[model samples]
Target: MMQLDDETLNAYLDGELDPVVRADVEAALARDAEARARLEALRRVSLLGRTAVDELSRLSVDESLQERVWPLPKPEPDCPAARTGRAMTILSGALVLLLGMGLGAWLFPSSPRLAGEAAAVATAWPRQAAWFHHLAAERRTHARPLVLDVEGSEPARLQVELNRTLQQRVVVPDLSDLGLRPLGARLLVEQARPLAQIFYQDAGGNLVSLLVALDSGPDTRPRFERVDDGPATAQWRRANTRYVLVGEPERVRLQDLVPVVAERTTR
Candidate 1:
């Protein structure tokens, strides 16, 4: 019998376990309902991530997105556009590096110099997601009503309601299967891109938000990296949609919802 820890279990789910270890995990799952549930959740998250990444790989780089994130100065006839363009390109690259480092610092406040792989994962969007989550959480905390339910209770109903409000097809995950209930839906915008955020509360009164957006890039998916910044966020992508699960860092409970999200947001 192999004792399962977070690392081992994640490795098993990711198919990184060797034959003997994999068999041990399977045996453990045969007798442990909790282990089985966790395994299912990891599978869902992994599949959703891979799907998003594969789809993104097939598409070309979005020029509009490039302009939005890294704007280049306009060319002038009097000056050499090529020279200016090259200089601007170098400047833009430096900006991206500085931005990543800034985000890394914000994410790992105690350890600003994130090393190797973690440094690579420290990018712009997670920082933005964490910041947005912090703002929203603070607002909810200070408000008289800690949580509010503005519309439907179920996923389908909520999706319809949110679509009406957003004027777009917003996929709402049915988290009832995981003992989570929808509190309501809200809209937030970033860089003129509207995002649909669905709120859920567990029996323990823990709040989690699913922030969904229709914009993504080629490098977008198949990864559920945890952000330990202001909020413990589990981020992944599906096609053009990017989803972030925002929860309190103290809670550290959003990972369990990854599978539920992966399954329910298939549409």
Candidate 2:
């Protein structure tokens, strides 16, 4: 029997394993509850890490601070080589500064402000949904196989399946007016709570996802936000359900559709 080590399980989750090895891991997972639990824990940790990185990348330094930290070179006569060199220098400096800030945050997480921010992020369902959306979008872009437990195009059927699996009412909002159609959905778990991500695509091939999860938090109206440099997201809680709509930032005006989805789901 193959040992289901962390590295092997991580590789399986990332779709980096060969068919034979993946089969072996799956077999082990089927028989070993401990292995399955370990895999889920790893998945949660990976999701949280990606979310933190996405949040960190969105941090912006003040323009004055950036200028003071890496003062631009004095302008010289127009030359391709000079321009390229200057651009490279600025890019490299920016990357270094970003990396340094990330390191500082990781090392000194005990800062009151930083700790509070971290706690808020950990509890934010919208951000978690955005992170999952980013992963799915990335895989779709790269033509990788999406690991969906339930796959289909019918909204009603998908809704029924999701609700059954989650043991909770799930609303699959129709966006036909917006030229989007249902593709499928996948189930996810966060802190043992179930989540469903319903996939949709527009006529132009733009992908969107609506993530539904049971919310114990207070009911709130839809609020729009961008997930770092990734998708545009609109999140809201209605009664006991939380919904997050995520789509391509350039192609989707998530705020406009928030009302449409909210009304339909609420009804």
Candidate 3:
């Protein structure tokens, strides 16, 4: 019989080995006190990780708790799973927004809270609503899309319902290779003008809203500001369109995605 090396034993513990190897390791563990202790330790770590994750999931409900970390509607207090999920939402979200702009959220003492809060509240809204408003306003004013299709495209106008309008907005990366999909085209408008917004989502359920506004550019670039104590936001202007992305206070993923939004708007 082959001696069970520590390396092979560890691989077996982590479930990285083949079934026969795992069986061998298990058999050895059953016979050896030392191996049994080592296996127990690994099991303990795995259990600890799962427990920590579960605990965090329980604490982050949208209810009016001591610190309502989340801005969305609250789940019933009786629903443990929803509570767990929402808590994870807030925890993960906080990690993202907080970490994303550490200097901005933590370092900036003046308006960090407001900037973060506003963006977070608006993050869930659909990009299509932003786009449709632009198109709809144009129809109402000049009666067309680009002053050509008077009466506006009824087919296109039918989109952007209140529910759709209320969907979460997000800033996404251009990961076309991963089979990621854009939210497609949606009309956007600000101040009664036409615009377009593209959206995308990732495996983690984070949504991004991107709009190509036809509205006049703000005289200045979008700045980081807090809104009602939610997430810190990065709002800026690229020539004509406005860029606003909001999320939890600390997120490396969102930070990495910001530049892609800028490039998309510019292009």
By TM-score, highest first, what's the ranking?
A: 2, 1, 3
For every candidate in turn, the CA RMSD to the true structure comes to 21.4, 21.5, 18.4
Best by lDDT: 2
For model 3, the superposed segments whose C-alpha errors exceed 4 Å read 1-180, 218-222, 229-232, 247-253
Per-candidate TM-score against the hidden true structure: 0.48, 0.53, 0.33
If the candidates were sorted by their lDDT against the true structure, best first, what order would they fall in? 2, 1, 3
Better TM-score candidate (1, 3): 1
Cα misplacement distance, residue 204 of candidate 3 (Å): 1.1
Q: List the global CA lDDT of all models.
A: 0.63, 0.73, 0.47
User: Candidate 3's residue-wise lDDT over 137-168, tens digit each?
Assistant: 33434432222211112323323431144232
Per-residue lDDT for 196-226 in model 2, tens only? 8988888988888888887664677665566
Lowest summed lDDT across 10 adjacent residues in model 3 is found at: 144-153
